[model samples]
Target: MASLTLPRHTGFFSGSLPTRPTLRYAAPVKVRMSLSESGPSIAVVGVTGAVGQEFLSVLSDRDFPYRSIKMLASKRSAGRRLTFEGNEYVVEELTAESFGGVDIALFSAGGSISKEFGPIAAEKGTIVVDNSSAFRMDEKVPLVIPEVNPEAMHGIKLGTGKGALIANPNCSTIICLMAATPLHRHAKVLRMVVSTYQAASGAGAAAMEELEQQTREVLEGRPPTCKIFKQQYAFNIFSHNASVLSNGYNEEEMKMVKETRKIWNDKDVKVTATCIRVPVMRAHAESVNLQFESPLHEDTARDILKNAPGVVVIDDRKANHFPTPLEVSNKDDVAVGRIRQDLSQDGNKGLDIFVCGDQIRKGAALNAVQIAEMLL
Candidate 1:
C-alpha cells in the first residue's frame, strides 16, 4: 500500500491540553470536512493510536461540534504533533486529572488505558464513550450502538458535571447488528450463528503495516515478518488471535455472543460465533444465520433492511454481486448481501445473511461519535 503524503507541521501547541479555545487542523490540499461549532467540550483519548486518529476523522466527517477539544495519549506519545481540520495540536499525556470540565471523552486506547482512566474521567463529569471491552458487560454501563439501540443510553447528557460511562460494543457485534436489527424488529430473532472474516485493521495500525511488509517480504522470497501475529499473515488465514476461553470459544467469538444479547436487550437469545482473521486491510465480513420466533420471508426481511438507517444492500443474484470489505472501506453504512432463506431449518423461520462494514469507521470511531451526538 502507498503511504499518504501529509503536510509537514510548522509549530506545536504546548502545555496542558486546553478545553476552552477552539483548535483547528493545518490546511491541506485534500478537501476538508466542515466542523461544527455548537458541540460539547470533547477529548480524544489515545490520540496517538490508529482508532484514536480515526475518531478525529469521523468527528470532522460528521462536522461534530465541540466547545473545545483535547488530544491525549500515553506519556511516550506526548509532544507528538497531529494535524486535524487544518489545525496542529500537540498530544498530551493522559492522567487522572485530564477530564476536568470535559463534556465528552472518546476513548480508544487499549483496555488497560481505558480501564485506568475511563472511570476517573467519568468521575470528573465527562461522559466516557469507551471503545474497549473493559466495561461492555458492566451492569452499570449502557452498552450502545446508536443505530440499533439509542435508548440504551437514554437520559445521559453533557454539562451535568456528574460522570457517566457508555460502552461501544465490539466491532463485529456492531456490524452484525446493523443489518440484523432491522429484520429482527419485524420478526424476533431467537438464535444466531456467526462466522466472521475480520481484517488486519482490527489489530491496529502496526499490524496493518506488518501485513503489508510481510506481503512484500514473501513476494521477494524473503522470510516474512512475524512481529504482530505468531504465524505468517501474508496469503494466509487463521482462527482469531484472541485468547481461547475454557468454553472452547476465543474471546473475540464470545464477544459476539454476549454483546448481541445485550445490544438486542433479549437475554433469551442464543448466539454462537467463530471469528477468523483474514488478510484484508480493512472492513469485516460476517455470515450470520438467524432463526426467528416467527416466519420472516426473505422478501420482507429485504424490505425491512431497505428502509433501515445506516445499511446498504448489495445483493444482486444476476450480477453475482455482493458486499465485500473492499467495497465498504471508509463507508459509514454497513452493507448486507447474500440474503436468502436457510434451508436447514424447518420453515422460513430461519434465514442466512452476509454483512460487511468498515471496522475502523462504523465499527469503532463513527459508532462512538454517534453516541456522543445523541448527548447533544
Candidate 2:
C-alpha cells in the first residue's frame, strides 16, 4: 500500500513508519510516554487504519498518562513497525488474548471486528471505547459524547477489575450535537433537522486516497478510479454510501437520527437527517435546523454556543465567513456559524446553524480518548 499523506503533525503512519509524524497543536511541554509506571495500560485496536493512527496522535498531544501501550491490528498488519511518543512498537495481531492487561482498549476496526473482540476484551476487564455502530444502539451500552453527556457513563472507571463498553456516536452526530446540545440545553430542542456534508476521511484512508487519485486522474485527462465508491468521487457529490434501509433512509442518515435520541436521552425529540458525501478530504460540515420548545433568541443562542465546551462559534455575518471543512480539518473544537433565526418557522423558536468538525479526530479518535480521560 502506498503512503497516504495526512495533515502535518498528526503522527499518523500512512503505510510504514519511517519517522514520527509531527505535532501541530500539542503544548511545548515534553510529552512523557511509558517512562513512568503509572496511568492506564492502553491498547489501540486496528493500529494501521486512519483512526487508529489518530488515537496515538490525540493521546500524545493531550499528554495522556499511559504507563504502557500496545498496538494491535489485523494479522496482515501484524509485525509492522510504528513509533509513538519516541518509542517504537511492533503492531501485534489482535486476538481474544490481546487484552489480558489492557486497562483501556480503543476499538475502531469496524463493526464486525469490534463485535468479535470487543466483548472478549471487556470480559478481561478492559474498558472498551468502541468506534463502531455495532454497540451504539445497544440499550446496555452507553453511547457517549463526552461534552454532551459525561454523566451517562458516570461511575465507569479504570481498575474496576470489571469491563464495560462505551460507544462513540456517529461522526455526523457528534459534530451536530456538539453545536446543538448547547442550544438544546438552553431552549430544549423540540425537533432537529440535520443535513451532513461529510468528507472522504469519514469513509477511511483508502477512500481518501481514492478521492485524491481520482482528482489527479481526472485532471490528467485519464479515466478516474472508482473502486472505493461506485461513482466518481472527484469533483462530485453523492448520497452517503451506507446501505439504504426499508424506510428509505440509509444507515448513515439514520445513525444521526437515532444517535441524537440516544445521546440526548430524549426519545421524544423528533430528528431527521440526510447525509451526503462531498469531495472534501477531511472534516464534516452540517446544516442544522432546530425547533425549540421555548423561544430562544438568536443572540442568546450565539452567546450560549460561545461558552459551550468543545464548541467554537464562528458566526461572522459581516465577513460572510462560516464554518468550512478546511478550517476545522485537523482542529479539535467544532466550529459553528451561519447562526440565525429560521425564517421558515416562528420567531425565535427555530434557528439555523452550520457546524464543521474533523470527523476522524473529534468524531472518532479524540472523542474516544476524551471518554478514556473521564475514566481517570
Candidate 3:
C-alpha cells in the first residue's frame, strides 16, 4: 500500500474528487525495483475495479519484478489509459488471447469472470492468482494466504509451463487468520469464533461511494441513498449483504469459517463467524476468540504475535489504544490487539484478540503480490 494519501480512484487512471479524504499509511521505506526485461510477464484482470487498481499499487510499492505488464478489463474499460512504473499503457479488453504471453495474472474481477477466464488463463500456462470466491474451495485450487500457507501452493510455480489457479482467501478470513494463525502455531486452536466489522471497500468502489454519499445526504437531512446496499450505510450498521444460507450464516461469515479450516488444513477445527458491515471507509476489524488444545498465556501470545511476520501488536491497555480500521487503512501489516485470556474458558487454554487490516491491501492485493513474489 502506498503511504501517501491517494485520490480515491475507480481505476488506476480514473478518479472522482473525494468529499472527505480517507487516511492511509506512509511507507517507511519504498523499495524501487526497476522492471527487468527478463522478469515474469504480468497481466491484471478486472483492471478497472477497486482491487484491480490496488493490484497495480501493491506491485509498484513492492517493486515486483515483471518483464512486461498488461492492464486488462471488460470491453467497457478497454481503450482507457493508465500509468504505471512511469510508463503509459492503454487498458485492453480481456480475451482468450490476453494470457498468451503473460506469466502471472492477478485477478480481482467478480466470481463469474474469474470462473470463466481463470482456467482459460491458467490453461495457457499463466499462474492466475484469483481474488474471488470462485475457486476458493475447489480441491484443485490452493486457497492461499502467503504468510499462513505458502506450502499449499508449493509445487506450483512460475515457468513450469504449467498454469494453475490460486485462490486468495476472503478479506475477513485473511485478516483474522493473520492474527490467529501465529497463536495457533504455538498452541493448537481447537475451536475459533470470529466477529467481523467489515468496511464498504469489501463491497467494491460503488459501495464506498454510496457510503460517502449517504453520509453527506444523511447529515443534510435527506433520505440516504441505498443503491449499493438495501439500507442506509452512513450512520447505521447491518448484517453483511451476502446471501443468508439455509444454515443461517451469511456467505461472508461462512467464508471465514470454511476458509479458516481450509487454510489451516484442519477440517476438524471448529469455526463460526458473524459478519457485520460498519460505517468505516476502509479496512476490516475482527474480534477473534480462540480455544486452544493446550495452555498458552496472554503474555506469551503477545510476544509470539510481535515476532510474527505481517503482524503488529497494538495492545496498549494503559492508553486504551488498540487496533482500529482507520489505523490499519492502506497498511500491509495486520494489527492485533485486545489480547487477554478468555474468561469463559478455563485455564490459559483460551484467548481473545482484536485484529484490523486493510482489506484492499493485505487482505487482497498485497497478499496476491506476495504469492507472486514467492514464484520468483
Candidate 4:
C-alpha cells in the first residue's frame, strides 16, 4: 500500500472551470506513454450523469494516462457526445461487450446496473472502480477511499489477469470518514452522532430540478406537488426516502450507519445519523458530535484535524469562519470547523465539529480516480 501525499491545491481544478474545456482537452489525441507507463484503455460507465461528468473532468484535470477513453451509458444517452482532451467522444450504449478492450471502468450508475454488469466487465479483464452501494459490503469487494484506505485497493485481485472492481463508499460516508478517520487514528472513536444537510445532487439531477420547480411554485402562492420526493422539497425538508425499514430508520440513514462502520472496520464504533435532504445544489455538510474513549480537548482535536490527510481545518470562530456548503461546493478537501468540547458529556471526553465537502469529488468521482491513481 502507498501513502497519498495531500495535494497543495484543495479546490477542484485549482480555479479551472469544468464548464469550459482547458487546453488539456482541446485536441483529439491519446496520451503517449512508455511500455511501463502504458496500461489499459479506460471507460466511464455512466457518462451522462453528474458524477460521471466529474469523472471526465478529474481525468482531464489530473491528466491521467490512458491510451484510449470510451464513454458508455444507457441507450437513451447513447447518441450524446462528450468532449475530453479536446476531442469529441460519442456516448455508446452500455452492453456486456463494452468491456472487451477496456482496461479501467469507472461506474457511477445505480447499484442495479453495477450488480448486473460489473462482474461481466471484470471478467472481461477490466479494472472497475464502482461508485454505488451494491457491492460495497461484499467481503470479496474492497470499498476504498484512497486517502483513508489505499490498502483496500490491494485486496482487489485481478482474477481474469486484466481487471478487478473496487467499490467507492457512500457519499455521506466518504465525506464524514475523511474528517473522522484521521482523528480515529489518534483516539478511539467510540460513538458518533451526525446530522447531515445533503444537497439535491446526491439524489440525482432530477431532484435538483424538482427543488427549483417546487420553490418557484411556493413563492408564487401555488401548492407545491411532490414528484421526486414524498413532500415539498422547496422551503421544506423531508426525512423519508425509498422506504423506512422495520428498525424505524429510513434506508438512507441506515446506509450512513452501516457504511461508516464498514469503512472504519470497527463494528464496535456506534454511529447514529439523521440524513436530511436539503435544497442545496452541490455540497454536503455534517454536524458531528464524537465521543471518544479518552478525553480529547478542543484545541488538540483542532490540531489533529489540521494536520490530517485530506482535511482542511477552517476554524476561526472570532471571524465567524467555518465551512459552508457554498464554500466547499467544488472543493476536494473536507473542511472542518466549529470545533469545541462537548460539555453535555462528563469530563469533556466528547468533541463537536462541523464538516463540509463536495459530495461529487471527495465523496464520489475524485475519490475513485484517486484510488486508481494510487494503484498506478
Q: Could you say which candidate leads in TM-score?
A: 3
Better of 1 and 3 by lDDT: 3
**lDDT for model 2, on a 0 to 1 scale?**
0.87
Model 4 quality (TM-score): 0.88
Residue 73 CA displacement from its true place in model 3, Å: 0.8
Answer with 1 or 3, whichever has the higher TM-score.
Answer: 3
lDDT of 4 by residue, 64-152 (tens): 78778888879877766554665567788899889887778999989999998899998888888999888988988888877787777
RMSD values for the candidates in order, in angstroms, are 6.3, 3.3, 3.4, 7.2
Candidate 3 residue-wise lDDT, 144-211, digit = tens? 99889999997997777999999999999999999999999999999999999999999987788788
- Candidate 2 collision pairs: 9-22
**What's the lDDT for residue 318 in model 3?**
100
Summarize candidate 2's per-residue lDDT along 304-345 as a digit string, tens digits: 999999999898889998889888977899999999999988
Poorly placed runs, candidate 1 (over 4 Å)? 1-38
Clashing pairs in 4: 25-85, 25-86, 26-86, 27-86
Question: Cα lDDT for residue 94, model 4?
Answer: 95
Error in Å for residue 166 of model 4 = 1.0
Across 122-163, the per-residue lDDT of candidate 1 in tens digits comes to 888889999999999998999999888898987787766778
Worst 10 residues of 4 by lDDT: 1-10
List of clashing residue pairs for candidate 3: 3-25, 3-26
